[model samples]
Target chain A: MPALIEAKNVTKIFGGGLLDKSRTVALKDFSFQIDSDNPSVTSIVGESGSGKTTLARMLLGLAAPTEGEVLYNGKNLEKLGGSDRRQFLRDVQVIFQDPFEVYNPFYRIDHVLETPIKNFKLADTEKGRRDLMIESLEAVGIRPEEILGRFPHELSGGQRQRIMVARALLLRPKLIIADEPVSMVDASLRATILGSLLRLNREFGISLIYITHDLTTAFQVSEDIMVLYRGSLAEAGDVDQVVRHPEHPYTRLLVGSIPLPDPDLPWEGERAIGRPAGELGVQGDEYCQFHDRCPYAMPMCVQTHPPLFHTHPNRVTSCYLYRESPELPMPQMTSIFKSSNREGPPEETEQLDALDAELEVSQENSSTPTSADD
Target chain B: MVEETLSAEEPTAAELKETLKVEDLHVYFHTAAGAVKAVNGVSFSLKSGERFGLVGESGSGKSTIALSLLRLIKPPGKIEGGHVFLNGTDLVTLTEEQMRRKRLDEIALVAQGAMNSLNPVRRIRDQFILAYKDHDIDVKRSGLEERIGDLLTRVGLNREVANMFPHELSGGMKQRVCIALAISLSPSVIIADEPTSALDVVVQWQVMDTLRSVQEDLGASVILIGHDMGLMAQFVDRLGVMYAGKLVEIATVRDMFGDPLHPYGQMLIASLPSLESRKARLEGIPGITPSLLNPPSGCPFHTRCPKVMDHCSSVTPILQEVRPDHWVACHLYEEA
Candidate 1:
């Protein structure tokens, strides 16, 4: 069977138009397939400008890739015929990051829910439309009475987002692209939204493409996770294998950065602040994008970008360390748990007055004219 | 008025002098519909150099409390009753001019969405200069140019960034610049509202480290307001849990996370998906946040409290000491 959605060597370049000197490679030679037959959640996890949003847009057919094709059901998304295109549009839906912005403040709440029903012709009668709306809303744990005759301003952010989910559920979309759906929502309420998505995936067998920078939530919801670093694929594979045992140095950094809830498990060593973003959007194809920040980077990484190499049947990592024969000596790999922060008994440093006096002297020195030269 | 409102117990001579104290604050928004009690009778104290964390869902008055501290609450939303003390001096009695001077000099605020807080039209250096001037400091006489460079480097930015406008910096960079500006004067107290919520995890870590290091360098107390329980656990010395315009619990960070006394605090910690323990299901607190315009009668959390009782609707719960250094406002823990 043809995949529901597939990106074949997709690349997106922004601002390289006729008169523009600047060019940004949002996604570079990226490819992934969401199988149609088997419905499961696929997560594209990356930081800002890593091209997760661009990928979501391409999959939704909202934007065309600059260099490659996005295939829907084995047919190019751009080339789909009238009915096929409509079908494709109806099948793939998006849940945006901010719920407040997605909704129109002027309209009544039902307008958003009803528009999908009317456009898709899911129901003919008013009663039928109402019933469908109620059913969809109920599926997302919202009652009809709660949302009935309410304006967009009447609902909370979580409620507004749940309504969006319900509106998408009304379409019975085969695939849903949730781009940071829970990022705007509170942590206490995130479980409800995530739970709703998981239930839909299981009960209705809907394929979900969860795009987010949050790795922990991605681990919770996604079966297959793709970690992106500056538009290049860092690692891709089973979430358990990838997250539990992240292969890439960037992926390890990402895993280590997650703030664990345990107070007992404080950061082991001194936390290192990230280097300032150095010359974004202008890297040579051969140069590894993560070289500057990668602790395990070798001299070869500056000369050549490592292609995706299979570490196991279930995992692929783009790193020279995983290579069979590396010219440079491998940097010692630190265990994320131990190396994340130096392991020590939590310090009971009560001598702040003494420290403050020292800090005061240093502060005065730094402010002095002579200190600048020194 | 401050003395009358404060409970009978006096501060012991041995007790540490609080860097900032908020006592029984009530800030309401006088909207057309009705007065929305955004912050109702909330109180907490920050000892000098303590990093305090406030965690709650949106519309739970966390930001309002932060705003209330700075007296930044605009018209139609006013602090109805409160005593904000800095080293035992009441801020509520200060005039506009006095309050203005107190801001940035004594208590600095790194507001939420600080990237957007920078003036789009102004250069970074001008903003810093303007802030110093607003606090009645002559930037040129103080050699603020060199100080600005030092501040930028302290937050991991180049001195050259002072020439750039807000548009020139990345979100994370802009946030660091805001931190730099906040700490330029080395204020006694700093209130950072959702400082890292917008940044990526790695960048968030970096920003947090910068803030921590900056706080340590200045020996300044910090009140970090964010909803991420995990980040709060790692960052703060004490945790204040707010809900529906009131602080429902206050405890040390270790106690709050190790064994939360309040039901809301417990559910909040439980709802979060911990990397350490991937629990099969997260028991998210039920119901949406109550509308502050017409909140529940007795306890704000009673509407959704898992251990709610019939008496919960009639009697308001006061934050009482449930354990040594831990306070909870639930009726379940109320003393006879």
Candidate 2:
């Protein structure tokens, strides 16, 4: 059987019109597949401008990719017609980031739950539709009587978001793409929302694409994880392996930056503030996107961008350090490594030294204890 | 009147000279429905050069307390029956002109969203200049420019950033600029209300790092208001857990995380997803935060408190010293 949804080397570029000179490559050559036979949770982790949202938009067929194609059930998403389009829409669903803005202020909250059932013809009578709504709401731990007649404003953020989850469950979609569903909710309520989503994946065999900036929640819910940096895949693997021992430098930085809840495990070491802004999505495919900020950056990173090299049986990282992996296709560009060693040129070394000196000065100026060990 | 309870700690005279002290703060908004008690009898103190954290869910009145400190509460929202003593001076009793001088010069606020805080049409330098002029700083144009450059550099931004507009800067850069402006006068206290909420995690860490460094250099007390428990655990020396506009618990960072006194605090800590280990299910605190307009008769959290006693709904618990440094206002501790 074919995958539920698949993207084949998709590339999305925004704003390269005749008048507009700057072209932003929102998403690079990305490919992934969710199998229909085996339902699993895959998390797409990235920063704000890292194109996580753009990928979600493309997968939902809301935006067309500039190059390559997005396929639902092995058919091009853009080309689906009649029954195929309707089936695709029914199977695939989305939960947006902000629950406050999703609802229509004029309508009662019941309208949100009733519309999906009416449009899909899941229930013939009003009573059948009401029963379906009540079941879905109770599945997510929400009392139907308390939430049925209330307006969107009457409910708390957590309640509104849980209702959205119930709305998604009304259709029993095969796949749910939740983009930062709990980011707006309270810290204590986050677990409640995520717990229900995890239930959807387990009790019901639904695949999930959990897109968020938070690694902790992603690790809790996702089986597989993909780390994106500036529209490029940094690392992808089993959630445990990738989070515990990150291969790519970008992934390492992201893992290090997470403020763990345990006060005993305070953040140690002088965390290098990663690169300045304004250079996002501007670099071409010629050079690695993370070269400027990467601590393990070498001349090879500047010379050519690295492809996803299989590091382990379950892991793939787009870093030159893993280029020696047996699964990597060694072809035309082997000559580039011969031109430069790890220590490339005197000028490049000097530039790195200058950056080091700047960091040192800022560290010294602070005069606080640099590490927790002290 | 709450000052008497603070004396129960039995500190030295030197220790009593706190940089900022709030006692019996009750701020309410008289809306059409009724009087919405946003902040009810909340009290805390900040020592010089200390980092104190105020954490709660949205509408728990953490931001309202911050605004009350600066006397920024407007007409509809009244700071009803409270005394905000900043350096031995009660700020609530001060005139508008006196409060204006205290703001940015003595106590500064780094607002929630940095995107809208800065002036869109003006350069960063011009904004800094305007602040200096409003405060009536006697300095030459070149000296002001040099001071602005120094402030920007302290927050890890280049001096060239002063020449650019707010739109040209990224979210992190805008936050850094806001930090720079807040610390321009070397205020004794800085209230950063969710300064990094809009930025990504990486940028959030970076911006927080900058804020910490600048704060250390100035030896200023910081009232960090945010709902992220992980951030509070790492950054703050003391933590205050607010519920339904009241401070349900207050303790040192180590004590609060290791052993939270209140039921709500414990649930909050348990609910946080950890990188160290993954649990089968997180124990989220059941029941919604109570509506402050018509709050619960006695204990604000009794509606959701798992360990609540019969008297919890009929009798209010006063915040008192349960341990040496730990303070809690719950019936469970009251019996002890």
Q: Please give the DockQ score of every candidate, comma-separated.
A: 0.23, 0.32
Name the top lDDT candidate.
2
Q: Which stretches of candidate 1 lie over 4 Å from their true place?
A: A17-20, A268-283, A325-374, B1-14
lDDT of 2 by residue, B93-139 (tens): 99999999999999999999999999999999988988888899865
Candidate 2 residue spans exceeding 4 A from truth: A17-20, A268-284, A328-374, B1-16, B139-141
- Cα distance off (Å), candidate 1, residue A31: 1.3
Clashing residue pairs in all predictions, respectively, total 4, 0
Two-chain DockQ for model 1: 0.23
DockQ, 0 to 1 scale, candidate 2: 0.32
Best by TM-score: 2
Q: What is the C-alpha lDDT profile of model 1 across A62-127, one tens digit per residue?
A: 899998899999999999999999999888999999998998889999999888888889999999
Q: Give candidate 2's error at residue A315 in angstroms.
A: 1.0
TM-score of chain A of each: 0.82, 0.84
iRMSD value for model 2: 18.8
